[model samples]
Target: MTQDLFHPHRHESHPKIISRLKRANGHLAAVARMIEEGKPCLEVAQQLQAVESAVRNAKQALIHDHMDHCLEEGSLSQQRAELKAISRYL
Candidate 1:
């Protein structure tokens, strides 16, 4: 499969991040199943919040690695583009 730029390669570079993400994936799948089964709204909302937090944490880790490695050494134009793309996260 062709990995896009946003693909989470950092997780492979650091297994801890991958493990965190794997746990989050299980949580996400469970939440989805709960929603499908008409679980309580409040419980679903809580699960959604947990998923959002997990995604943000994963994204932050990836961004930190990208900035420290790719963007830092890239040319000015590349850095500018990366900065613009990264801003979308915020």
Candidate 2:
């Protein structure tokens, strides 16, 4: 299946995005460990929710950066691309 274009080219091209994702990865691992260790379900759910929120913020940051750096001109194509990017979140 095709993934969202919101973060396309991020893994190979953007160091900052990768760094943010690595942090999120650590959060996910911690959440998983909490579940495995029989931590309270509500607590683990909260941690997982935090991870999701962090990822959403990371994606928003990436989109904002792309607007500033990759599509600075604010052209129609850029708008369309950004729409496509943002659509992934829906």
Q: Number of the top candidate by TM-score?
A: 1
After superposition, the stretches of candidate 2 with alpha carbons farther than 4 Å from their true spots are: 1-13, 73-90
* Tens digits of per-residue lDDT for model 1, 1-90: 124788944434467677779989999999999999999999999999999899789778877766666666567987888878886885
Reference-based lDDT, each prediction? 0.79, 0.76
RMSD of 2: 5.6
Clashing pairs in 1: none
Residue 4 lDDT, candidate 1, scale 0-100? 78
Runs of candidate 1 with Cα error greater than 4 angstroms are 1-13
TM-score of each candidate structure, all chains considered together: 0.71, 0.66
Clashes of 2: 0
